[model samples]
Target: MLKIKKKFGIDELVNLTSILAILFLAAAVVLPHVRAFRYFALIPWLRGIGLGGLFVFLILQAWIHRKKVSELFGHRRARSGANSALQIVLFLGLLVVLNSIAAGHRGRLDLTSGRDFSLAEQTKKIVKNLKTDVLVTSYFKETNPSSMRARELWKEYSYLSPRLKYRQVDPDKDRARAIQAGVKRYGVSVIEAEGRKVEIEGTSEGEFTGGIIKATRGEQKVVLFLEGHGEASPNSQDQENGGGLSTAKEAIEKQNYRVEPLSLIAHPQVPASASLLVVAGPKKALLKEEVSAIASFVERGGKVLLLLSPQVKTGLEQWLKSYGITPDDNLVLDYKQHYFVDASAPLINRYPFHSITQNLPDSFFPAARSLSADRKMPEGVSAAPLLETSDSSWGETNLLSRNLEYNEGQDKKGPLTLAYAVDVEKKEKRQKTRLVLFGNARFASDGAFTAVGNGDLFLASLNWLAEDEDLIAIPPKPPGPQPLVFSNGQMMQVFYAVMSLPAFLLFFGGLVWWKRRRS
Candidate 1:
């Protein structure tokens, strides 16, 4: 080692000092203009300074020993440079691979285990049919989890189509811009496309996507409220006194649908724009011409919503037979103890397993009647039950008489069908015509509109009729109470015991066994 030190020279020190000075000058001149490079310049400056100082110390040590500087570091300089270059290349390669994977999979990877991908099909359909550029600006509160979820969902939208642009706007930070854009709620998405805009409130990506589809789709949907048969009318005195037509009309209008009153007898032809015809609780029977016109409308791919009551006449029942839907004259009576409200009264409590009622709560039905499928079902028509009475229910055949008490064998035992949805295929055009025949229309009346999922059921049926069932809003789960208060000390103790007892036992037992073994 002493013989090697004798070969180190003074010229190496001068070269190292020159390199350090040049690196410092480059860092000082370039760092101020380039933000990214400023951070990187520090690394080279520190290396130059550190290596330069070491070289100077080595030269001093060599001078004290009367040795040449080249003998000390000449052989190691080339190896050190090669090793550092290789390490830097390895780091850069790793960084590029990791960044590429992250960019490709960022939005696709969901950290939320409970995320739903069921609406991906519908989302894809909208994306593939995009005619023009669409911008989705999401307004969210910075601290809200729903805001984060909305961003994640928007990322999926962007991933699906390059035409769609997703932007996040914080209402708190960008107050003036948010106000000008008319964002009322946190986590609301405003979709703008083709000179049109739609504001979608709530935190549902499915609903927001549906709103975009509806806004872009040029055809206007018209929901006709059937009148002139003592049916509830949107502008009628009956609604002012407590009818459902006005409420239902308002709800439908909010969804960008036009509402109109149509009397088949008054104007025999169903309007071309009519997507759905609602016959809500008609007290009178339809005339022959009216019945024929409705049948023609159905044959021409028009949707019909027939909401019947126990008061429906015989002529209407015979007319409904053309579509294979038979509304029973008998009123349903539930004997189940678990049924909501008075079980003895004509109230429906249980709903059948169908799209409309699948996830609905146990809905209450006031004065509900029974419906059945006739053997006269049209060819290629599919029927599904929407609502039914429990097995403990009986349909009182003599609807005129209000006698509740009856022998077990005297009454028809359920599950009795109360509402049936039929999708009839048109022979001429091969288009599916939807018909919903409900035994009790009063469930949708103003009197019982809010009875559990009554309004939701009505909305779902209308959407189904229009072949826009995916637009129906799924009711959000009720939020649990926050900062749950323990009412009593005993309750608090019980809660702690239930939550921590097993963990405490396991931990203490393990600790005791470890301590004993060590002892």
Candidate 2:
């Protein structure tokens, strides 16, 4: 003990104290992220005591070198050099501190022409008003482009509110943890809140932000799609036949809704928890019992969405007529403004002032039919057109005709109804039944849903029907348009200007130097 005490002199003590002070300060900066460091008993004590000991050692060292310190201070060169060093140190220190504060309280400016880098207002509102903390963990390979893109996008979420925290994990380096988290593939993310988790497989803003919303919102409302009469399957991937509604299903799921195939033939009654029932593009006629079950469900204040294709016999004429809704059998033809390939695929840019169609873009309907409401509607039932075609469009009587033309007396007039929203209320009861009818289901199918505002329009309709009006109006921010292509001659001019300017300057400089040396 005497030898050890002799070896640990004042000079050695000062060095040890200085080193300890640096370590403790580093721990203070790093502990928040490490989390487990706080459990160490020595860290808290070291933070307070280490810094104090450093100050004491500094004072003692100064006292021991009093004469030398006074001589150094008196020398003009030494004082000037010390002042210069101090000024540099102070300037660097200020820079570091300002940088840290700026990073912590930074505001993001999305200067992209389309505001593509910014989150939607709806998403910002949701994240800002979150009641619980939502953690978004991205599982991706370090070298993946999607990982970088995801990091850039999720930065907005982290900056929007304190409740949202974004984290990225290298799945390859942390294989065990990634597997435990159920991340089987790269470029996927997991959002967790309140013990509930939602996995997003896509990197689009719609998918990731939707997952955050789903995870934060605890309960999932069931959206049942009617099956059994050869309607488009939600699970189908056949894009050409319009047999898939995967895109529509995903959009609804993002809004904290669950999509399930519901068959009235298999089940006697609609599930009590069914938020909305969708009957989309049924080719075969529904059984009488199935129709009865749907009627019962609607009578009990259930919401319904009916998407009928042109000339498809579903045998719901009487059932629809009871609600003062008429589904026309004629085919919708847009000769003036239609998809390039077919005139039957009408391009509809007109929308009425309704919640479902508000802020929606032009939607293309392939093989669309027309809808008409009774002039005298039922007592408690009110109807309004949600989407419609222009005055140039007409409901053609013959869909089989290769050279189609509007028949004078047999076909419906121009400006036909393509979609309608209806509200049915009972006077004595508080229950109300809501319904939406779309002339064409193919537009909302997987193949065409992402085109224009088809997905947005469908989501809005579902939100209104489910009484979730708050989630209705948010639209996806598409990326900016591609830059203009330059011709080879134009490119050559740019190349020559960039490459020759510096060379020309260097040549002129060398010539001037040569002339001066010769002179």
Please report, as a residue range, the 10-residue window in candidate 1 with the lowest summed lDDT.
478-487
Candidate 2 lDDT at 428 equals: 70
Where model 1 places Cα greater than 4 Å from the true spot, the runs are: 1-133, 138-164, 168-190, 199-213, 234-242, 337-339, 344-354, 399-403, 407-410, 426-432, 472-519
- Candidate 1's residue-wise lDDT over 185-212, tens digit each? 6777888888788888766654666666
**Best model per TM-score:** 2
- TM-scores, all models, native as reference: 0.58, 0.67
Clashing pairs in 2: none
Model 2, 231-281: lDDT tens digits are: 988778768999899868767777889999998887769888998899989
Model 2 TM-score, all chains together: 0.67
lDDT of 2 at 434: 94
Cα deviation of 79, candidate 1, in Å: 25
How many clashes (backbone atoms < 3 Å, residues ≥3 apart in a chain or on different chains) does model 1 have? Answer: 9
